[model samples]
Target: MPEGLPLSHAQEALWFLHQLAPDSSAHNTGVAVVIRSAIDLPALHRATDELARRHDLLRSTFAEADGRPVRLVGPDGLAGLEVLDRPGVSDAALRAAVEAALAEPFPLRERGAFRTVLVRRGPQDAVLLIASHHIASDATSHLVLLRDLLRSYEPAAAGGDPTLPPLPGTFDDHVGAERGFLASPRGAETELHWRRVCAGAAPAELPADRPRSAGTPFVGDVCRVEVDPEAAARLRAVAAESGVTEFAYLLGVFQGLLYRSTRQADFLIGCPTTTRLSSKTREVVGNFTNTLVLRANLARGSTFRAAAVSAAEQLRAGVAGIRYPFPLLASRVRLSGGAPLCRLTFNMLNATGSDPLLGLLLDTEHEDRVVPNAGLLLSSLPLPQLGGELDLMVNVRRSADALAVEFRYNANVFERETMRRLAGHFARAIAVAVAGPDSRIATARLWDTAEPARS
Candidate 1:
């Protein structure tokens, strides 16, 4: 009706930022799907060529005109997909190849939007490595692309021609629509409100344990900590009794953990918002996320339940303020000038869909993720499909042997391990909050890795 294809709201949002800043949130995470299969050099090439022709965005890149950035689409100049040839190579070999392929620096200019590097591990074992710069993509995009490509690779799944449903509007149309909306009176008010909320808020200044280097320093320090089954049960009851989403309850627990660990009066923590409102945006994959700083000021003696409720209310309010960007606050808010809004970020994603590599069913016996960067990364990875079951991973600096909250204040401004200890502390907090008043959650502690004792 409108044009080639109408981008869902999330796609439009990403396109909006891609047009403005080529290095926006769109370029945050890169997805790598390790596939082991005999390389069909000719077949794969044909498929990739078709894919590049079918999706213009995948072949497009950013260009500078009069010092302004613009999207440039044309015939892609990508290399032919190769086989890594690692037959006897250990799991570590496959992993290192994937990481090396991803670590290759991408220039912001030219048609460097996305590229696929095929490592031929062996005749029957090869990894399909795809590394796309985030400026033009998101995690959902990766999942969708991977899933679609796998479907196409199926022997029975139709061959030759690929037919995509007609799109209602082009990405540019959505961009125009958003531009018109941002020019409204309500839009201006949204700016003012955020200004008030963030006025004088200072960033959590965290110094690297080691000397810093130039260029974008990716602090991918991580620590994996899990709560035993019994502690998880206790947390569930407390979350239910508190009447808050696990996110909110966890936020409260996390804040208390950070405060107890760092003793910082005020600080900001970052978290990713799905930002997908309607079903279209939700299902249509792309980066439709906004990062917000969850500020906490723990009052001494405040119960964990009270702290959790406070955290819950703030998240509710913050998510509603989607139109406000962190950068906009720079123009509106006063005080704490030039300080980072947040140094730590949290992402709680629940993506359950057709496995990206369903067709080529390669035996994925050993799987590991490489996220070597993030000042502080917290991920609630895909777990068993059950209501009470959840796995929380806290990855911090290995040498610092601590958590992000710990680095809030200490030898520098925070100590790392203390923050990690707080991650455990949150579980303890939830156990306490949800434990009935007559019962003591203080006694209900979370045991990591192994099983905890019963009362």
Candidate 2:
């Protein structure tokens, strides 16, 4: 065993959070890629092994040493894939298998934080399960892993030498760089900005079906709704006219709903920002996700266009000032009895580079996630079982054709019907905003159970 290296500040915070509920799988995250083409099982196994070796974080385990978190880089052999042959398994069975894999928590001190499972349902159809501890991976890391796996598998499947590129740096090097920056003058300046931002932040809780638990649980449920291509196109037009990205428009709609839901004009919302500040860290796979808290103090009778423009400005600032670690910032803010600083999370994840990969034929590509209805099949996954740190997360993804939103909420605190109603309200809010960006958002008639539908 190699001597453990101290984890990045972000990783250390995640480690401490995971330790809070050692048995829960709330922090587990992964992606399941379904391939309907011929998969050379042996080649895939070798490819995964090589990929893990290339990225030290894939084989990273964690434990505490002298009161600080340390990452244990396990051997390459620890990153091998587990193949499960389920010839002619039913769709329900396949779903159950995927769920089981997702629910499996990592033994942080024992094994590496990554696992790969190949479930073969037939000769040509199989689902690849790639599970990783959130502390070890993030949204971009998932794409990086998939890109490398495919690149590695293509040649290995053909019995040829793989042409995988060398990673520019390792996760350890990232930790060292982060430490150096955090100790410098710029770090202190960033910390001060964070303190100022967080000092005004409070948990923006929504009305729930039931009271919150003393300690949050990871029990999760998802409700998905899609903005149809027509609606999406209209939104695009509105965004173009407003001179803001579609995300900013969607965010403005969400902020409008938040104002209505909470009835608080001044509240904080959390947005996830990537910490890959430079191209140097682009190819390196590790946890570089940062959570930024933005103030949503919408003015009464403000137009959605104005809100979106303001949101766009905040987003730019947030991205530019996201070098500070979120955990450390959260720690700096003093909450009442250790309460969370923010509750509602609104994330508009951009799905790029995966579409071309999907268009290739099964035999030539050797992988197929071809879906007749892209919105339903590519809907957002459930929220990260972050031990119910937040009551609700609005995860939106704008695919090639449609804009899909999944309201992932705590089952313990929300009923399915409540979420369904909320989803409807969100759709209405966006539809109204798309129709008239200049209209006052507060004046828009959001749906209520008692209010009859507009004729």
Candidate 3:
């Protein structure tokens, strides 16, 4: 057992946020799966126990050692599962139970950072809820955990050896690599690159419908933005013609939206980038995500195509410097009023060819076999509201045929109608830009009425 293990740079940033608001469940990352089949209770229990044994992060807690946060990995065989068999639970009741479980905060110094709850509704129906603090997991980790759980349950239920293959690497190994990188010459170069990129960039602030005061709690609400298949196809065609990926083109569109709404020519937007640079750490269940501050500079009288090309260039540069930690950059690059540098962020979760990690884990072969082996049918359940940390987070999920854009905004800062208007304007901007790629951004129609365009 390792002793006095330091938290990774990402974990340290989460720890600081946890300290600021200890009771907030905003940092929880989780997934819920509905099962429509008879389950083996004992086997599933054993599977959950095995999951804790396989990953040390599932049995870990945080504490202060000499005025610094350190991870304390506990012994194996920690049963993190809670089984609740309700014979006559309604759909609303089941949803309420899952929400309560997800909203429960973890006392970092006392209990483990993982939670598993099995709410059995009937003989052939159940919902499995798994959640962990962001310090211990990421979006990809949820898929990894689900994969391992099903792998362990199959053998345990059949009265055979339930042993699994050893992990490629541990989370501690990732931490060691990060520490070493920060001390290397490459790390210095990465930091210098970020310093220059963020030297004169102003904080990107969206116009809020309500007044924001100090010490507002981080409560949030989500609104859906619908994009038809035709629009999606047109957007993709425009992206290819512009010589940029769909992500870059969409990011440029978002920047154009901000420019039209707020008229900020130069600002920063937060972009989350993956840090699983090697196969060794790819399968490791930990926080392997880093935020990259992408600068969007729209010169006066520039076209939408020019904005996208600039975005592609800046995105290429930003990803190159992703090794520099956000918290460290926050300390070094001082902004006025102590505001967060990247207040508005853009994220894309594409079903095809966007996220390789998720695509690999939830591939057709694995997805087909996992549930049916237990005589189960996967059910669609509403995703849990795992709160937000930014004023506005625009997530674009691309499927095979259409794009689903969701805007998650702080309820304390903006109203629901405001988000709806923003979404409408976003759709309009895309249509205008793709229709006339050479038109001046200032001439793009944002509202129904015609006004004198700025030069």
Best by lDDT: 3
Model 2 spans with C-alpha error above 4 angstroms: 335-338, 352-355, 358-388, 448-455
lDDT of 1 at 139: 54
> For residues 1-455, could you state the per-residue lDDT of candidate 1 as single tens digits?
11133333444334455555554322334455544334446556655555565556666655555544455666654523545555677867766876666655555455455666666555655566555654555556565555444434443233444333433333444344445545788668776666665666664433334433333223332333544345444654676788886557667776655555445647776665654455444334334455666677666655677777878877876776665555445434555645556655544432223332321222122244321111111111211111000012232211111112111222222245644554555545545555532332223344453542322
Q: Supply the TM-score for candidate 2.
A: 0.90
The positional error of residue 233 in candidate 2, measured at the CA in angstroms, is 1.1
Q: Write candidate 2's Cα lDDT for 78-154 as tens digits.
A: 77898888888897797678768877878878886888887778876677777888889986787678768877887
Return the lDDT, model 3, position 140.
Answer: 79
- What lDDT does model 2 reach? 0.75
- The TM-score values for the models, in the order shown, are 0.71, 0.90, 0.92
Instruction: Give the backbone clash total of model 2.
Output: 1
At residue 151, give the lDDT of candidate 1: 39
